[model samples]
Target chain A: MSLAPSERPGTHPDDSNLSATYALVLVVEVIVILGLYWIGRQFG
Target chain B: MQWIDWAIVAVYLFWIVWTGLRMGRKTEELESYFLANRSLPWWAVGLSVMATQLSAITLVGTTGQGYNAGLSFIQFYFGLPLAMIILSLTVVPLFRRANIYTAYEYLERRFDSKTRLFTSLLFLLSRAMATGVVIAAPSVILSVIFGWNLTLTILAFGIPTIFYTMKGGVQAVTWADVKQMVVIVGGLSAAAVALIMGLPDDVTVGAALRTAGAVGKMQALDFTFDTSTTYTFWSGLIGGLFLSMSYFGCDQSQVQRYLTAKSVDEARGSLLMSAFWKIPLQVLVLMVGVLMFVFFLFNQGPILFKNTYLPAVQSSTRAAEYAGLDREYAQAFENRKLAARAMAAAQADGAPAGAASFARSEFVRNDTAVREVRAKATALVKDVTGDPDYNDTNYVFPTFVTEHLPVGLVGLIIAAIFAAAMSTIAAELSSLATSSVIDIYRRHLKPEADDAHYVTVSKWATLFWGLFACFVATFAAEMGSLIEAVNVLGSYFYGSILGVFILALGVKRANGDGAFVGLIAGMSAVWWVDQHTATVYLWLNVVGAVVVTVVGTIVSLLTGGATAGPDAGKSAATRAA
Candidate 1:
């Protein structure tokens, strides 16, 4: 089977796309933590 | 408690059974029975994964946790999204590409049949016992709350699950899960709405949340670096990550869910769905509990939520002491109600920061006073009943449901709890059937059999396991400490299993001898660390995984490391044989 450029091992989008997905998930997590922090400070 | 409520629950059971039976027609072959012919859509498979992981205990217990601990428990899931992402990249593709029936089936190819046999045995033993506890928990809680017989309650939870899973196979389990997910989520949403409506009209939603925040219920993030604490941000993120990895990647119950997906990308999508939604879903569960806490602030609630021994406590010699403590709890609860009102009002009125903070501190003190009285009452109950390790957290949500929810809705939520139990039970029963037949029965007793013959035997295997799990549930409930024993056994095995998988996929040099020995070393280390140190269950997964990898690497190198990949897997297995 012929492989797509991005689908090949050690290639761009697979690596880069996975990295982006990781960044996005982690970033959202940090935002959630910060949101909780703000609620505690504002309301607690 | 009403006739209408009973009808609603009966209808739910009948509906689920009907749906499951309808799906059973597709399971004519072994592949279809276990893996749904590998044609399932990602979304349905994703819901099945979520529903199967959630159990009746978590449904009831988490709300209780929210009522008691607030949002700090959410940190326990901090590593989940990352775990899902990692598994998508690694195991989702690996397991799918290997095209195996059981996760341990790969172990045989990667190492040796003995390794596959050993790992599969570990999965079977731990999972079988754990499934029993899963059935017992809700039944015990329901029996206590509603005056139902425990034996019948166990059957009520178990039999229908067996019927559908035995007849319908994995297709039935997955489709039923899709519907159960709807019921489960709907019930939680209904409870949240009712709790909000239950709050005194004088208290706004904002005020209620702020008051709960004052007592630390709204503090979802605990960024403490303390390794000693259970639900801190670090523990949840790091320890939770390892646990999630092990659970989703290594356990067949979960692996079977994704393995049915139509493509590798579909498999990855299913896991990523969990990655994106698990914490938020947990937040919804925890928020219901927090809302319950808020609802109780203005309302009177039981001092001790679980009242199984309420009669005994009343009739025993300690009755006077229990009554006295009850009175103390009432007074403290009353004071806290007033204090919570003031705190909520102050925040709503935009009181000066100093004044608001003062009101909050008073509220906290009053809450502490109520909890102290509860501890005394709980102690008195333990003395009277001769059952130790008793706590009331599991009872809180069920109690709230029966007392506060409208009659029809109470039945719906009860059915929802049943849905949760059935979803988990169904998945595990099918998985146990799959592993027992494919890994042990077929692989050993009869390596060659028609699909029809195997499917017939697989059905019998499913029935046998269902009955066996029900027996275990009944036995565990009678032997109260056995529940904890099963839990500890699972905690010991989960990480070690994951460690073997990591050694297979990530370490090319690791062979059968190394993987097998590494698994033993990993479990032994976890046991030793658990006994010798104060390391919590979460960190133990990390320890097990790390020790197995390091030990396996050394053992493999000493044994002359791998010749290469899957071929190495086969060669290593042959050499080990």
Candidate 2:
């Protein structure tokens, strides 16, 4: 059987978008964590 | 435990069984059974992955770790995100593209059958034994709390899981895991909230945290560069990264989680989800433990958390000694609580010299008492159980749940613990069955078998492994601290397996012979280091991976390359004949 389309050897079709999305998620995660830390410090 | 608790647990079991039975129709074919037809969404796959890793032991034992040892353990997951990002870029895509049922199947194509077989066998040995321990951990806790036989407890958890897994396969495993994750997370959150409410009125969340911080429980980051220390920031970042990579990248249990993703991007996303959430999740679990520690400060808790061991001590000749030690422990805790309160008050009102000195003296005395009781408990356990290494770490959360949690919530928390255990057990059994059927049985014994035949065999394999895990669980009591047992087992083989995978991808010249020899050598070296060196076990993953790659590459260079092609040709010819 042939391999799945997304598993093919060429560059991923959504590589750029995926990377950008992932980067954004990472940034947002960090910001949220920092925000929580700040909040903990203030109210804590 | 009340009727409501039993009802909740009963309902949970019924729902799980029903979910499994529902997936039976979809599991008629091998592909559907093993890979869910590679048609899962990223979110489901992601949750399954997390559920598989965050077992019941983690919920109970990790919180206990936080309560006892502090937050330094959180550093152990520091490298997880990096490992996930790296794997997403590398092995994940390759495995998806190859459309291989097992990771070892790719090894045969890239190197030789022998290399594939060796690595797969190593995986089976480790995962099977580890799965048994996973089953045992929750079983022991349940048995202790409910006064059931441990062996019966093991079967109680193991049997239903086997039936569901055998009936529904990957589809059942994944969806069941989703429900299990919900129970686990919900239960933990509920427990945390209940704990906070149960605390004395003066013990606000902030005050609890401050107390925990004063006792070093809140020290999440330790920048010390000690290779010998297991949970330092540097060790965690470097060693933890290697361990996570080996676990997620090479271990079939985790690989199977991502393999079911709908696309390469989805698989990467699923892994990234784990990477992002693991540390924070661990932090939350540890925080629960820290809260529990603070709760104890305000309340009188058992001098020895292991009540089972306590009774054993009372029955022993050292009963008086134990009783005396218990009194000392009580006094010490009282003093410590006073010190902790003083420290909290001091910190609140700007630390005064007198308050600081009082807190310091109390802290020292309380710590001494804690150690003294622990020593007595350890000695008593050795006398009773005939094992000196028996530690009370695993008992910490279970004791809290049984003693403190309200009736209905206790049942939910217990169900949650079962969810954790079953989730990990299901994933491990599924992967074990997949590796056995795909890598060995299907490829060698019956290459021309239809999907139905393969499906039947897969179900049987799942059942077989489940039984094997149950049997192993019987002996798991001898193993100390379920968390440490799992990690030690992983370290024994993970590095070498990861090394072989690296060799497969990076060094084209590394033929099967080289890979095979290098793998053995890598494992041997890891064993040697474990025996002779003082390095933390987690770092062994790094050492093993590096050694396997370096040694495999060298062996490949020494032996002329391309032996794998001829080897596969011979195997094909033998099959044809």
Candidate 3:
């Protein structure tokens, strides 16, 4: 029997939501990188 | 060291052994032994995940990095949280649903058997050698500090780990890892606090930061677009993203961590927990090193931290030359310290221009002296050891630990180091055994074997890999940084493995032969890139995964001749074959 999408243990339900989360995470990561760069330029 | 320090270490070791022995009863079955019956709490799994990642090399080498280089190293982990979050939504759930013993097993189901076997073998080869190096890292430091034999130090820490892991399997490994993580964080946090408190009364934490900032030690990021550089923002984001994805997604060592979680949500939650904490935690760890750099500025710091090379230089005929240089270095440091204090006082007195000018000259003089001492030390070491590979950047924290921390705390910290080493060693060995027996032996050689028989063989496999790691640990001293060596080795293969998984998941048309060929091509491409390009090793993941997926898909289209229907039975038979 094919496993239902929701019944499947590890897979999240919505791809769009997952993509949005990923984009959000990428944004945060960029900010962190930029922040570190600013700090390095100022202090280093 | 005091008796209290020994007592703390003794108690910690005793508890570890007890925990391992206690968990032994639950390890009789293969599933329970390998995956803790998939019943672990998120907290335990989370802590275990963090513990496995933070080895003794991190505790010592990273602190040493901070002591010398400042906080730039923290940028290396910026991609980790993003990687973790991405994996949670994709591979974490998929692997849990597949219900496989190893991550490699999923490659067979999704792509082909050869892909699975190739990836599993890569993991074994990398992790086995890496385990030896990991064990040897702390042992080298201990031997240097205590004047003990290296082989004895390896055995002292490695043997107990083997006993528990071979006895209790993943149950012992996960529980021990939880405790080890606690001790490691406690030891590091304690060290940071002590270093801060121990600074000169005249220097506030703010002033120390200002000094470190002034000296360019507080540089935490590099936004330059240089593929050749190891820790730039782009390299960290793109290269680090792929590396983290491949590591957390496909590598069995980490895959096995989440597999033990009670449910998919728990596993994803546990991984997310690591995602959330990884960057900040690394920042804290590296900050300890930066603070130590500040500490050394106010206090009298050693000209050369690794004392092992000092004796060799003294014994050489050029000893007089080295001694003269050392005398000059000491006098230079004295003058620089006086100048630094005067500059600080001048700044306090609102003489900005005078303070700036004095600080500028003092900085140059101090930096010149530091470079001269380093060059002298390196040359002397080369002369004495006859091995040009001796670098003392990795030796900084061990020197600090042995020389600075109080007696009782010293033993606790030492035990924490042992805890970190043993946790990683135990996990790698256990996962190695699981992959070997379940993915290879049980699938091909003994398909009809009973649980009891498989369990017996698994224990034996664990013992075998453990013994092999200890044997390898004897030679690990030749490697410079155990942490860097492990990742470099992983870079050679992790990208290719991640590629196979991507093909299996995203490309439905990709057949077994295509995957098998693509896997080889992927590894070859990565090796070529590594040999030819100036790109950082972390970027190998992106190169390998993308190459394998794109190549594997094209090869599958050419070979399979436009077959569009899902070939589930064909895929299964290919795996069975």
Candidate 4:
């Protein structure tokens, strides 16, 4: 698997990009959590 | 408890200790003692990470939650995978490259000794107290079931874990955790299967699921944005992310688990493993509780799940009142069971489904009446015992196991509980020792000590903290629910710790004094909100982290930016020290 340019060893993102990463992951997690909520509603 | 069950538990205890001890010979230095020589594979570290987080609270208290409230409590974990990903991209790489024995050691490199010591002490305080509660929870069930005293139960589980952790160090904790995770998963799976099998032959799994759903026990999500509520989807995802970040990123107990990996990528892999498995695992554990709820529908469950309280109420002056309530509860149970069976039959017969819906409503009414009577019985038991805050949610699964499960399976479940408790307690003891010695003893008091001397001191620290945890366990029974108490206790400090770390890692101008005062400010803000507002505890993590970062940044600017130097403390001497 190819590594993201920012994800390679010794190549961390700058402060702005790192902050963006945090926001991006948060949005992704919230979406997945909503998916879990969907599963519970459907199966429950 | 049967002899066969006792024998299974005994063998499990012996096997874990032996496995731990066999790894002890690998520890020849401080690095090896704490990080397993950084030679561990990602999968082993991943399993250990998962096991350490899946404590007795998850096994017992969470299942109790499922039985009491349903799958809604699972929203509390929605932030975990996100937190794991964040940690993988950020702190895991930072800590691995820093070559530190404890996460707080990196704080010193970034800020100052005072900052490191303060955050490290906070971790020691919260984790040490939480460990007591962790060990206390399962011991309550074991003592009640086996007729042993609580102290004896605590020690029986505590001593071996402390011994193995002190002797074998991280290597032992890691491998033991791997096996313990397997045992925990297997044991819970067995109990789930047993519960389904124990249901009347006519009640198929799908029928049981429908029955559970009909009673509102299956609704797992709540999107309503209510700050006062505890387990809504928003609170779980946002607040839970902050909690998970504090726990997996900043807490040494969890951070140390992943730090044993061979490289930064491996460490990240270890956390991602948790991201993938944690929610599914929690779903299964809570499913066991949901299944138990279904099982008890056909069976006659006790008026109070806590049997100790039953005896107390029986012997109290309110015995006649209690006896009356008990009869009512039994009758209600019968009515509820018949209604549930009728609903199942109607659904199977391809009727209009109206009759099934009516029967569901009738069953719910009877179940509600039974619960009201049980509440009165609990109140009476509390008055007689002079113990307020008595809740029996933690006792639900354990009582079902002891009273209902087949003999061999009972032992396996009990053994799994032991594994769950021991895995968490061992990790706490080991991490407590690491921070105490690496962050305090070696860094401050004995900075020039040889590796042999530091290793010996670390072992002694483990024993001291182990004893401290046992003492704390004695008072833990009064706490309402073990899982909530531990998490609430964590929320009190975790946000502030995470805030301090964020300042250390993300903000270039953040100085030690700023980090220090900001942490206190963050904690005080959380305490104020906890006391004065109706905000749920999960949000406290977010509150604390934000308070720390904002307060720390403002304080830093006021104090003349970056007191140590331009690059903070990342000098060759400090980095290589």
List, residue by residue over B113-135, the lDDT tens digit for candidate 3: 66677788888999998888888
Models sorted by lDDT, best on top? 1, 4, 2, 3
Write model 2 residue lDDT over B1-577, tens digit each, in one string: 8899999999999998788778656777777899998889888899999999998889888998988877778778878887887788888887876666888877777787888888899899889988988888888877876799888899989999998988889889999999998999899899889888986765567766766665566666667887777788788878888889989999999999888888788888899888778877887798788888878887777876766776666788888877887787788778777776765666555666587557645665676676677677677667776766666677778888888888899889989998998889999999999999988898789888788888988889999999999998888854666546666767979988989988877776787888898898888898899989898888898888898998888888898864544224333224222
By lDDT, is 1 or 4 better? 1
Q: In DockQ, how does model 4 score against the reference complex?
A: 0.17
> For model 4, what fraction of the real interface contacts is kept?
0.20
Best by lDDT: 1
lDDT (C-alpha, whole model) for all candidates: 0.87, 0.80, 0.78, 0.84
Off by over 4 Å in 2: A1-10, A13-17, A21-44, B349-368, B380-385, B478-487, B562-577
Q: What is the lDDT of residue B129 in candidate 3?
A: 89
- For candidate 1, the per-residue lDDT at B109 reads 66
Query: Which pairs of residues clash in candidate 1, taking residues 3 or more apart in a chain or in different chains?
Result: none
Worst 10 residues of 2 chain B by lDDT: B568-577
Best by DockQ: 3
- Specify the CAPRI tier of model 2: incorrect
Q: Candidate 3 at B399: error in angstroms?
A: 0.9
Model 3: DockQ score: 0.32
